[model samples]
Target: MEKDTYKTLAAPGEETLFKEKNSKFFGYAYPVNSEDEVKAVLEELRKQHNQARHWCYAWQLGTEHIQYRANDDGEPNNSAGMPIYGQIQSFDVTNVLVVVVRYFGGVKLGVGGLISAYRTSAQMALEASEIIEKTIDVHFTLQFGYQNMNKVMRVIKEKNLDIVSQKMEMDCEIVVATRKNNAPTVLEALQNLYEIEVKTS
Candidate 1:
């Protein structure tokens, strides 16, 4: 069976730039998992761009991408944050963040201009980034006596399970990571071994 996977920014911390009407927009992209990670990235940007006029951002999390937020940061409503989020959706990426810092240049860009500027700046940053495919994973601990170890090992080998850790002796324990979507099949096969012990951690 195929495992579940999704597209996301390769890693955190890519900087790109876009300018309009002498206003410099510095866009930063980050691969984030939790809200805490997003906050850390935002805080880092705030410290780095303390003089900037606006710090707008958008983030999407989880495979379902049910959690997300767009912050305009003093920019006109629907101008800054939404546009950045639009680009994230456009890229079809989740578990990612884009923040654009605007250095005002005395010229006031109206709503339309602000939207376009933010959108384009964020898009540029995303374009400069390397997107990657990631799989949802589950971890489990498998234990058995030496007598039944071969049965468990054979099943693990057949499934190509990732060994997170292993302790092999008279009694053996193996910690494995595998795609979350494949867990049911793998777990069922492992459990079929009558004398083996399987536990998820």
Candidate 2:
């Protein structure tokens, strides 16, 4: 079995915000998820920071299969969104959104400076909060006789596997929920211990 892939989230129903200041630009970046959600967030941030010059953004959605978008907004072409998007990609994150709000500080920052500001702001925001990769949820069912139930249960316990559901009839049937990557190992271990039926769902 191959390792399951997932993206990282900053926190549960929480967002990370960061601010950076250069001689020419003041920037704020937010790391988020979902296009509609990030758009709403950008609107709110724009409203809150009405004086800002530009609100640029980027987002990556879906699982290992992903969809992505970036917007320069009013900044130089590819300055804001591209850099922010690069940072998120560098971290191999998916299902994430980033918006960089720029407040012009009266001086003109060249394209390089603009890119640096957006990238730094996003990286900082991600670093400030705990980012955890998502896990793929998979379930497996194991069936064995009463004679093997105790030993199998012990092994399951030792593995700290999540018991999603259980059924007991003439024999004992157990259902385990865990990441897809771990399911094969779990099933192999159980099979080694005794005659058991394993099904992945």
Candidate 3:
């Protein structure tokens, strides 16, 4: 069976801080849906931490069809961004952005040290977030006449579907949403009704 649920952050996580060899790493996590949102958050953080030496970050955008990106931001390749991304994967969260801003403290940590610091900072950020599971939903449009309202409503109620919208004129139209796993059953029930047209939307 295909999985129909995903975990994500409810809101921006509280800022996290980690220090190693006098270098400061500031970590932040935010719920985001698009690359644009990710970019905007990075822009805001750069402004907020103008004196920071590096802004390494990672983001995962989708649930089923996953999309992700990691930026080293001048750190050694795979030292900053990939470690942060690994933390995201370990936490099993999507639609989330993790950023670790570094303040150089007159010391240069080697690749291994940098990786450990970035990974720990990212993990702390995720731990501070409120993770929640959400169902992947499928939408369907049901079209019928007023005469078939009762039949349509019965199926919706029986299946515990959510009514996204409805127009109850003589020609009735309803938009309903159900969990992706239950969509086939809901579609079949609606299609079984006479004179009712159902289409996935």
Candidate 4:
């Protein structure tokens, strides 16, 4: 299966503030590929919004099959993070993160107002940035003996294939990572020179 790719920007290295009414929303958005990156961004947002009333966030990650999470961060359940997450989904994007900071406007925007504000903030930030889609890479493992190691390695290097991992057993096991669209070509090239086992990861 060919994987899809998308591009997103990272959060500002420094904090940025957006205001509506008396409330100040400090926020930052970043591109994330895995749970660890999402968690790191959430932690950074928490730290940046330490003095604010709430730190809410949402993220979408993966290629064909993606996962997402949202947190209201102490605000009325579903009022903060959900709205921001909705915006992310609406954009049909993956591997993206959005954090919204609320300072409390003194005048509550009510549920509707909160939702609108957060959604708009997230949408605007995404719109202001650039996004690109590319092909996602897939990994395959090839096992062969020392006799064919040099030939296999040469093909990988010449084709600019990613060598994700390697191990030596009775036969050498090499894990190669390449774009899904290129898998067939890569496999054919390898099989021509040596016996190879291809597996997806």
lDDT winner? 3
Which structure among the candidates has the greatest TM-score?
3
Q: How should the candidates be ordered by lDDT, best one leading?
A: 3, 1, 4, 2
Q: Which of the two, 3 or 4, has more TM-score?
A: 3
Q: Roughly what TM-score does model 4 have, to 2 decimal places?
A: 0.79
Expressed as tens digits, the lDDT of each residue in 1-201 for candidate 1 is: 564888898776568889899999999888988999999988888999999989999999988536999999999899999999999999988999999999999999999999999999999989988999988888889888989877887988999999999999888999988898889999998889988889987
In model 3, state the lDDT of residue 94: 97
TM-score (all chains, Cα) for each model: 0.87, 0.63, 0.91, 0.79
**How well is each residue in 84-106 modelled by candidate 4, as lDDT tens digits?**
89977887677888888889879
Instruction: Mark the 10 consecutive residues where model 1 has the least summed lDDT.
Output: 1-10
Record all residue pairs in model 2 with backbone atoms less than 3 Å apart, i.e. clashing: 32-97
- Give the alpha-carbon lDDT of every model: 0.90, 0.72, 0.96, 0.77
> Which pairs of residues collide in candidate 1?
none
Clashes of each: 0, 1, 0, 0
